[model samples]
Target: METITFHSYRGGVGKTVLSVNTAVQLALLGKKVCLVDFDLRAPSHQSLFISSTFSMSPTAKSFTGFLVGDHEPQSVINSTDKENFYCVFSDIEIFQQKESKVRTKLTQHGEGRILAKLFEFVRYCNTQKFDFLIFDCMPGVTYRSLDALIVSDKIMVVTRPVKSEISGLRLVISECYSKLEGAEIFSIMNQVENIKDLVHPPNPLDVNFAKVNVLGITKCLEESSVPIPLLHSFPRVPFVTERIYVLDEKNHPFTVEIETFCNKLLQK
Candidate 1:
């Protein structure tokens, strides 16, 4: 299994959106994919696939459930309408109920069982042998995020054109890359106005890191008032407010960017 972790330095850069949508795009291509939401701050991946899925219940068997021994590690995996795509989301109840405990597990570093449980969860994911295991990581430099970086075979630092976010991504590369031996690093520039403008010289953020692949740019999502439908056939691109881009429509212009991104991953 190829383990990919999606991360961002700051919040509100659409990290979870990119992670979930990428999983959907891969599933659309008929590949077996699993998305695990490690965004303990506010896990929301379950809402995206819960309605139409006939798989495991995020509320019944969540990451917290597994950690607290309420559920088995393998039993929490939930499937979606997309045949082979699956996800493991933290139960909102458990997360809120065990906030302090969860925080302790994630922040206590080496002197805790949370990290060990996390690796055990990683082992379960690897054991499944899914073609891809996408980790929807939380923002900032928490120990949990660092742990995700450690486990990832490849890391995609989701950044925007903003200076602070770019600098944060750079810091992540400078510090984390050395620790992650043999792991490929990617800078997936999100919320770009123009992909072409970025490719030319004097690129945004200057692109000096050799291991960091500028895996093209993904366009900003559009906001909408209409509730986006649960995707069955993807014919339209996604809207920022809804999972519409590649999940709702396949022929949308955004689909090309997703195709290119996933293809680049496959190539690596």
Candidate 2:
């Protein structure tokens, strides 16, 4: 199975929205896809899929349970009503406990069983004929996030047009390159207000991210210079707030963009 992980150096950079939209776009293309929520500390994908219909239950069968060996990984697969998009929700409380334990062990052995469990989960998905496995990684370069990066085939770093965020992206790149060695890495610029006028914006913070390959709502997807050019940019639409929670593909601007992006992925 091909694994694509969406990561960011900091939180609230629209990583989850991008990840979920990308997965939905891929699914609409008739490819079998699984969107796994590896952001154990703050799980939100489940709500996006179910429209807040279901809360992440902190039970033995949840992702936290699976990670802590309290339950089988297979038991954590929760199928959303969305076609070709199954989800694995995380339990924040359990994740904290397990992550702490895993981190301590990694310091001594340079390894841990969590990675093995993640691999096993991937293998299980492969057996089920999943064409793509999209991981929505948590922000930051914690041990949990690193595990996701290690297993990912391609890493997409999401960022905003801000100085601090861009600095964080550089650090994220450094960490990923250090651990992933030669894995494919790409960047997606989020919440871009204007691409043309960015040559000299009022906010100096925006200038820092100017060096990286960027995608904006104003640019045509086919004309993008970035490797694995952005699939689509949402364009600060008010409807995105309402559409993000709903599964209906027609009303959502992000969903439409995702569909277009998915077509591009298939072309690859």
Candidate 3:
């Protein structure tokens, strides 16, 4: 299993959206993929498949349960409608309450008690024969998110074109990748208006500091009311009323870009 962690300096950069879509596309391409919602604090990967009326199994019975030994890690792995694709969601209820303790246990002793258990989880994932394992790590520099980054084979930093985001992005690159000897950082710029803009190196001054090869840049497909990426957005169709259906609009601009990005990711 090859692990990839999607991280951002802050939220609202379409990190989860891109992770969800890329995982699905990877599955569609015949890779046995697992998308993990490791964003423990405000876990919302379920929102991708959720709608006004539909709900998934509660988080207490999810991955967060595995975090605290409430359930076996294998039990928390849930299947999606897409074949060969699965997801593991963070437990908002338990995770928020236990985060500090979890963080301490993970980081205090350098591969300490908590991480030892989590490594068991990773070993279990390795046995599952998955081709691609992806994590939607929580935004910012939390200990838990950093732990995930440490375990991943590749770190994809998702950022936006805004000034504030760029500043933070530089910090993330300098602190996390510049001096780090082992990990390779992949840069993905989101919410750009035009593909032409990507040709100019984003945050040119930090190119040396980041040490990341640009993977791809995607356009923002957001609407006013939703205030989130439109890649997961679904409207009421003829038969489906309340459920968010799988996106099959191959010709939609957003879908086109997502597929293109997925292709680029595989090429790299």
Cα lDDT of all candidates, in order?
A: 0.65, 0.65, 0.64
User: For residues 108-210, what per-residue lDDT tens digits would candidate 3 score against the true structure?
Assistant: 4544444555677778889999888898888876667767777777777777655566557656655554544555567666655442335565665554333
Instruction: Please identify model 3 stretches exceeding 4 Å from their true place.
Output: 52-60, 95-111, 195-246
What is the full ranking by TM-score, best candidate first?
2, 1, 3
- Give each model's clash number: 10, 0, 0
Q: Where does model 1 exceed 4 Å of error? A: 51-60, 94-99, 110-112, 195-239
Best by lDDT: 2
Comparison by TM-score, 1 against 3, better one = 1
Query: Candidate 2's residue-wise lDDT over 1-268, tens digit each?
Result: 7888888888888888888767766766677888887887788865665564433342225665676567776688876555676677776554456557643543232466777777888888889899998889888878778888888887787767555664565566556544575456666667665545344545655543443334222232233333334444444444455234324556565666566656665665
Candidate 1 whole-model C-alpha lDDT, 0 to 1:
0.65
How well does candidate 3 match the true structure in TM-score terms? 0.73
Displacement of the residue 206 alpha carbon in candidate 3, Å: 23
Which candidate, 1 or 3, has the higher lDDT? 1
lDDT of 2 at 69: 65
lDDT-best of 2 and 3: 2
Per-residue accuracy of model 1 over 1-268 as CA lDDT, tens digit each: 8888888778877777677778878888888898888887788776766543334454436775676556778788876556887888775664455556654554557564666676787788778878888889888777778778877878776766554554565556555554567666665666654434444555545444211322211111111121111111112233555353676666766666677777666777
| All candidates: TM-score | 0.75, 0.76, 0.73
